[model samples]
Target: MSTQFGAASTTDDVLAGVDLKGRRVLVTGASAGLGVETCRALAAHGADVVGAVRNLAKGEAATAAVRAAAEASGGSFALIELDLASLASVRAATDALVASGTPFDLVIANAGVMAAPFGRTVDGFETQFGTNHLGHFVFVNRIAGLIREGGRLVNLSSAGHRFSDVDLVDPNYDTTPYDPWQAYGRSKTANVLFALEFDRRHAPRGVRATAVHPGGILETELARHLGEGEVEALVTSLDERNAAAGLPKFQLKTIPQGAATSVWAGVVASADDVGGHYCEDCHVAEVHEGESMDGVRAYALDPEKAKALWARSEELVGETF
Candidate 1:
């Protein structure tokens, strides 16, 4: 009840009493890092998992790895190709799932890019915003029917959302200058807002949605764009933000620790009860102000902004759910 599961807790630690037998789970970007661990943990607990990835080869390898890790639990793993950057791919993946008619208990939107140079996705939106937010948006809405009653949408956001809010006016940087971190922040903010609105619309049907900041830097492909000195610079900036917020210095987490909150949100019945909240370190995070570098900002949780984002997303994707 305290949600005090610290940065040291792993998916296994948080999921101790939670039984996932026969549950159907999906994880995006599941080939490595937190995604792999999330699948392993779920599968280890007897949940059937399908890891959606961009590459079939990598996905197969990841599935094997997770399967091997999960042998002790008598669980299973499967794979499907899903490139969030391409709506065509997302549609195909959803079609495959719909064909299989596997009702999902949870869908984790875990794949994302970070701090890359200015560019646009194939759909012409900013790379980070397009892939991280819009891609997940379309995929989730399309599969809304495939989600069983009381299912959960776990959008993996970031505490870096403290850096900025969604820029509805210039989301694609058509009229404004682009800053990488700011763009990433906007996407993360959108992730939370998306979950907020998603809960509003889907709750009546018993499906709930929530966003999570997995907490701290872990070794993942998401950071592939970072340069030599960027890691230290990012940490220095994070420390400064923590100092400004009167918080303790942020500590880096292990891969298992990084996946804890996500796993908690997905399978913990109590967490689903707190739908639409932003969680971190396996607890509902506090909303803070000004350079906190931790917690969800009030703006990210605003219902109005969430609705506005929903509208904008519909326009961008040229489709409405």
Candidate 2:
């Protein structure tokens, strides 16, 4: 794919001139933030979009723009109830989708919690890990067959994955102490590994999967758990770290800019270039061994680790793909 797009590219910039009239897409967390922007852009380009939300009322109220865009562009938009924090909800949603027998051109696991306080999901797993990783694991795998042969899966991972690798043995924090950021990190890393393994399993059928890190954006609902002044302090710390590494100060992206990479990988970029990889800023990220915000970590893409994670996820979810 020859292109000129980067960190600053908005969803519209990445999708300019592209028509998705016959495409069908599923975007989770569609009620707010990046998910809302992602759905709006895809619908505006003529894709039939299904926005999955934990709360239908909130989703309907939040997606007025998406619905209007779809109507104006000859595309379509609808909503589905999904709460990634609950296995029952995931099962019900996936079963209903599979029963509909409608195939999707792409499935973007764009819903997730970030740096949330310590808590357990409905199934008693750590909040971030359960909602961000395990929920998508079962949700996607169960509906894997509904993805057309050439379809793709885009898991929304994060640069925060560098905080720590998944602790499979202590995933629930039973034996290990709970730290919100570390838990979030584990879940984010699981997101990347899940995409990697899913790609390995499905690529032979022409279905591909990739993970993307939407650059930091402060205005999203994702920061709701942070206390007053925490965002400012976090930004200061990040900038100091970047400056010490001789890099420019960290800059938060707009929602459109933040969601750009998802559409780029899901629609614009070639499968061969992004399949089984971690992407950021509309391109495949390099594997960086150290702590930095610019690239993916080696451990996050380890094939063996990905496989291991897949197995453990199956065990925890009590479901096999």
Candidate 3:
């Protein structure tokens, strides 16, 4: 089956005729933007979704919005607390979920911050690296048992991964000059590596994993770190380039469009048998070549790097699985 749904496909469109009854989906960063849309679409398709957000008030509002949308469309959703910057928070949330005795059929590592000013997480690692990569690392490991066999993990990465791979020697920025965008790139690269390694290690346990570049949805929380002018300039530059290539306008994806690849990865049977691939525009993206900003690079998908990253992550977060 072709996974190449275009920018025009809505969440409902990708999910049509796909039944998710009795399935449970856990989505982080569910307060607004694509996360809310992802949760809404999953609920609409008969999956019970848990929206995980850091702020309770915002999460409640987000949940209400999804509930309202679901009521009109016939679906269901709930909300929970999860702060990716703090290992304690990740642990507490997973503990609560375990206490509730629910096994997740899909776990979407969807919450992340981008290009924030140099800072450290509560765990003392660089904030972006800590939250974006390590947080999901520990979270998934903590709840590995609760994932149903044949379950899937969807890591929300970005094309910015083309900017740089992990600085293996100084992942925390302790030994290098900190560049915010580079740090963000490392974190995103980490996301891809995480999926690659997770699939290698856990696929045998019946847990499959994939990472996705959710197609440049501009309004997601990650954009908060960019100035308005910077955002405009970035979009404008991409637009002109796409036009020059005779491609469609480089439009910022709508929430549903942005989320299609991830939602598809979670439920697609074709994906069931294929793990460790990077996806974009709802398809397995082609590997790119020198001096271009697209597709998964070799090092980012390297099993050795993935394995090393997993080991470093265990040391960084002090968690073993």
Best lDDT goes to which candidate?
2
Query: Candidate 3 at 241: error in angstroms?
Result: 6.1
Q: Model 2 over residues 1-321: C-alpha lDDT tens digits?
A: 746999999999999999999999999999999999999999999999999999999999999999999999999999999999999999999999999999999999999999898899999999999999999999999999999988999999999899999998989998898899999999999999999999999999999999999999988999999999999999899999898888899989999999999999999999999999999999999998664778999999999999999999999999988
TM-score of each prediction: 0.96, 0.99, 0.94
For residues 238-310, what per-residue lDDT tens digits would candidate 3 score against the true structure? Answer: 7776676666666678778898888888887375544798888777777885644556887789899999999
Candidates ranked, most accurate by TM-score first? 2, 1, 3
Q: Please identify model 2 stretches exceeding 4 Å from their true place.
A: none
lDDT comparison, 2 vs 3, better candidate:
2
Which candidate model has the greater lDDT, 1 or 3? 1
**Segments of candidate 1 deviating more than 4 angstroms:** 2-4, 269-272
TM-score of candidate 2 versus the correct structure, residues matched by position: 0.99
Candidate models: Cα lDDT each: 0.87, 0.96, 0.85
Cα lDDT tens digits, model 1, 77-170, are: 8888888888888888887778888798899999999888899887788999999999999999998898899789999999878889999989
Better of 2 and 3 by TM-score: 2
Model 3, 260: alpha-carbon shift in Å? 0.8
Candidate 3: where are CA atoms >4 Å away? 69-75, 239-249, 272-274
Model 2 is weakest, by summed lDDT over 10 consecutive residues, at: 286-295
